[model samples]
Target: MNIQLKHGADRLLFGMKESDVKALYGEPDRKYKDEDKNVIYLYNDKKVRLTFYQDEEFRLGYIITANNACKVFDEKVIGEEWSAIMPKLEAKGIRAFEKENFDSVDNYFNEANWVIFQVEFGEVIRIELGATINARDEFDWKF
Candidate 1:
């Protein structure tokens, strides 16, 4: 919800090699190269391109496109057991449903890999899942 960064709130401002960029973000959906020989990282809804040029001192000058990014994560660890984990997840703004109705709520997280937590009717249903966004099934979404 409210993530406050003390210093480097700029998500795109990274200090790693070019090769590691994709590892930071998810795999790039597409790529493009400019006439100047620069590489661009393209996502489904976002794009970031990098350009390199030589300055007067022969130092590398770089230009980065799409300086801002939204960080989404699906993997997480829940410290408490089911009893303790349920309330915690709800506090984080995750919708809680009836555990007996787990099937009804499956679509919520199945369509989105970045699932912080999933609770059911004041009970912990699932936690600590991986970043695996399954294909959307219209039937599954029906509740």
Candidate 2:
């Protein structure tokens, strides 16, 4: 998996419609609405979850991938530790982070929480990324 930060990940870019994604990955293992009411399409075999919701248009909003092969900023991040990822994030100028009091997982935020590394057992388990939409460009579609 190749993460392009707020732009999207791999061949699945942000603002992609369901048909666009389905065309790429075929059918999903499961598709349902999440607790937040966002539509979630889960591909269990690929360990990826795609979220879609309505802001202006009902389209892809976020992508969460758990593939250990996932790469971001030219580095393999999944299954990596904070000590290791910290350097990579810092080296890439992703300096802002927040370690909350929760014990389940520690999240590393890069650029206004656009891309996050959800770490558990001291290793990254999932990478959640979202698209950055500038309302000024709402009329322009990038998909």
Best-matching candidate per lDDT: 2
**Which residue runs of candidate 2 sit more than 4 Å off their true CA positions?**
135-142
Clashes of each: 2, 0
lDDT (Cα, tens digit) per residue for candidate 1, span 1-143: 11111111123322233444455566667666656554545554443333222111211123222222322122122222445544444565554443334453322232232333344444333332222212572111100
Off by over 4 Å in 1: 1-9, 47-143
Report lDDT (CA) for all predictions: 0.33, 0.80
Residue-level lDDT tens digits of model 2 in 16-67:
8889999999999999987777778999877899988755455888888998
Model 1, position 81, has a per-residue lDDT of: 40
Best by TM-score: 2
Measured against the true structure, the TM-scores of the candidates, in listed sequence, are: 0.28, 0.87
lDDT of model 1 at position 70: 24
Taking all chains together, the TM-score of candidate 2 against the true structure is: 0.87
